[model samples]
Target chain A: GDQVKQSPSALSLQEGTNSALRCNFSIATTTVQWFLQNPRGSLMNLFYLVPGTKENGRLKSTFNSKESYSTLHIRDAQLEDSGTYFCAAEAPQGGRALIFGTGTTVSVSP
Target chain B: EAAVTQSPRNKVAVTGGKVTLSCNQTNNHNNMYWYRQDTGHGLRLIHYSYGAGSTEKGDIPDGYKASRPSQENFSLILELATPSQTSVYFCASGESQSQNTLYFGAGTRLSVL
Candidate 1:
């Protein structure tokens, strides 16, 4: 079974608009991390959460371990924000590795 | 900034050939991991290590092996490459704690013919 599920397989938004990505986990996860795979194919870490909310400039994220879900909110989207967003969760049963979601492909156009 | 570098950004191998992908991290993190990315499957863990001389299998470890001889280096090996194994491989390093953030490499694109 798929332990992690991501929403909105794909999305497109205007440069100045806002959007949110989500992930649902069936496993008992201890932590969650969000990553942005840029146009160059580089996976850049965006946030690491522990059942709380975190904000980084125009990006914000929240994790609810009890509910087994996480969300990433992007504000004032820019052209540079066009990329694939992935969420990974760490669980004791899953070992030291983090289980990842299928990811959401986001396109922020002018 | 944490730096994780992977060697051979791109590779091409024939069927049944051996392939080795190397990763080096300057962060000196205790945990290192290898994952593969396919078109529909975002990322799947293959192998990981907790420290030097300790390697563990992840969700999808069959037909693959991992080596962690030192704190800064980890390698993923494919003894008999297959076309199905062709994908973008990424290496990452993080602190031992689950809450710690992970730093990833640019990834290596491998093509097995």
Candidate 2:
């Protein structure tokens, strides 16, 4: 079974628009991490959360451990934001590794 | 910034041949991990290590073996490559206290035929 699942497998946004990505976890998680895999195939860490919300520039993320879900919001989408967004969950009781979601591919056009 | 470097950006191997993917991190983190990225299955953990000389099987470790000979280096080994194992492999490193925040390498693309 997939412990982590992402919604809206693919998305297209126009420049200056805003969109959100969601992740649902079937397993108990204590923390969550969001990543962006750029066009060059490099995975960059976007945000790390502990059952709360954190904002970084045009990107904001929330992790609700109680409900076993997380969300990432993209504001003022840019061409550089076109990439694959993935959310990973940390279940302390499971192991030291984080469980990852299938990911949402975002394509922001100008 | 944390830096993780993986060797052989791309590799092609024949079935039954041995293949090795290497990763080195400069952050001196205590935890290192190897994962494969497939089309529909974002990323699946293959192996991980807590520190030097320690390796643990991850979610899908049947055809993979990992080695952590030092704090900065981790290696994934495939003794007998198969076509089904063709995928992009990524290596990550993170501190023990914040293992969830991982720093990944560019990734190594492996193709087996």
Candidate 3:
């Protein structure tokens, strides 16, 4: 089984709509981070959460260690949101390194 | 925000050739990591460094070697590049040894012909 499994391996969204992506972890996690890889190949950090929810602009993320899952929500999706999203987690045992998911490719169309 | 950069955004190599991916961070971070992304495998750790002159094996370090000569620079080398070794490589920097934050580079796409 994968330590981290991301849902909606691929998604096609209509511009201005809202959507949510999820990540489930088999390993016990202490912290989680969300990233958006743009078309230019640059990965932009979205949110880094401990256990609660954090909102940045039109994006909101939550990490539930108890449930072993994390969610990334994008509101008013735009054309620029068309890229891959990854959720990485750090376990409690100590290790700065992260384990990433397969990623969710999103394409927002007009 | 901290900055982590990778050189040669794109590369193409032949089978059995040598390929080196370079990364540099100006944030003076203590931890640096290299990850490769594939179609179904996501991003797997290939190598990581705690500091200058120190490197450690990662989940997928079979055909890869890593080097850390300075605090800001870390390199991943493929001495014998194969088609299977071709993937999008990412470099990241973090501030702590344990429970820290990470910043990533743009990424390096290597294609083995």
The DockQ scores of all candidates, in the order shown, are: 0.73, 0.69, 0.62
Interface-residue RMSD per candidate? 1.7, 1.8, 1.9
> B1-113 in candidate 1: lDDT tens per residue?
99999999999999999999999999989999999999888898899998999999888999999999999999999999999999999999989864568899999999999
DockQ of candidate model 2: 0.69
Candidate 1 off by > 4 Å: none
Per-residue lDDT tens digits for candidate 2, residues B1-113, read 99999999999999999999999999988989999999999999999998999998888999899999999999999999999999999999888875458999999999999
Estimate, for each residue in B21-107, the C-alpha lDDT of model 3 and write its tens digit: 999999999999999988888788988988999998888889999999999999999998999887899999998754477899989
Task: Please list the residue runs of candidate 2 whose C-alpha ends up more than 4 Å from where it truly belongs after superposition.
Answer: A92-95
Off by over 4 Å in 3: A91-94, B97-99
Candidate 3 has a DockQ of: 0.62
Q: Model 2 over residues A12-94: C-alpha lDDT tens digits? A: 99999999999999988788999999999999999988888999999999998888889999999999999999999875432
Q: What C-alpha lDDT do the candidate models reach, one value each?
A: 0.92, 0.92, 0.89
Best by DockQ: 1
Q: What order do you get sorting by TM-score, best first? A: 2, 1, 3
Candidate 3 chain A lowest-lDDT run of ten = A88-97
Clashes of 1: 0
Fnat for model 1 comes to 0.80
Q: How would the docking of model 2 be graded?
A: medium
